[model samples]
Target: MKTFARTMLAIVGGYVGTSAIIAALAGIAVAAGGMERSEAATLTSMLGFVIYLAVIIWSFADPALLRVALGLGAVSGLSYAVVLLLARAPV
Candidate 1:
């Protein structure tokens, strides 16, 4: 039961965390207008998948359940803040 709980938590945390990170990055890139919109979309799609895989591997490999949760939560929260700030910035 404990193992199952940890696994589920890790999966959820990784998914949410990875998504938030990707969104934050993509938003920043878009706001900066560094790349063409289509290129950004393509890059985001490919990079998002890679990030998800990495998060999954890391989540399960790390034995510290609390660390996994807290780390992800922190990253997600920080990412959210960054995205929000970027959104409000003058374009």
Candidate 2:
């Protein structure tokens, strides 16, 4: 049961967390680097592959399932919040 849960979290949670992080990073790049939205998104999307792979590996490497869950949830939630704020900010 635990292994099943971990595998699911590694696949689903990692993807969700990675996506949120990529969005947040793109927002940051657009805001801070003054980059065009499309360029920022393209760069972040490419980087997201590596980030997602690392997330999946870490999810499995971490022995504590609860910690893995918490980390993923926290990061995903925080990144989503950043995305929301960025969307609301004036250009």
Candidate 3:
């Protein structure tokens, strides 16, 4: 039961972490005006699969469950927060 719960949490973490990271990166690129919006969108869309794979692998590779949960959760929160902030800010 405990292992199952941990696995579930890992899956969720990987999903959230990868999505948040990608969103944040794309948002920042667009908001910062470093690249064209269309280009940023394209790059992020393509990169998402790689990021997702990495997150999934990392989730299972880590031996410590606490680290995986907390680390991924923190990363997700930070990335999403930046995304939200950028959303409110004028581009």
Best prediction by lDDT: 2
List per-candidate RMSD values in Å: 1.8, 0.8, 1.5
lDDT of 1 at 29: 75
For candidate 3, what is the TM-score? 0.87
Error of 3 at 18 (Å): 1.1
Q: What is the lDDT of candidate 1?
A: 0.78
Clashing pairs in 1: none
Worst 10 residues of 3 by lDDT: 5-14
TM-score of every candidate: 0.81, 0.96, 0.87
Q: What's each prediction's clash count?
A: 0, 0, 0
Please write out the lDDT profile of model 1 over residues 13-34, one tens digit for every residue.
6777777787787777787767
Give per-residue CA lDDT, model 3, range 48-83, as digits (tens).
Answer: 889878777777787887887888889889999999
Query: How would you encode candidate 2's per-residue C-alpha lDDT over 1-91 as one tens digit per residue?
Result: 9999989998998999999999999999999889999999999999999999998999899999899899889989999999999899998
lDDT of 2: 0.94
Error of 3 at 34 (Å): 2.3
lDDT of 1 at 49: 81
TM-score pick, better of 1 and 2: 2
Candidates ranked by lDDT: 2, 3, 1
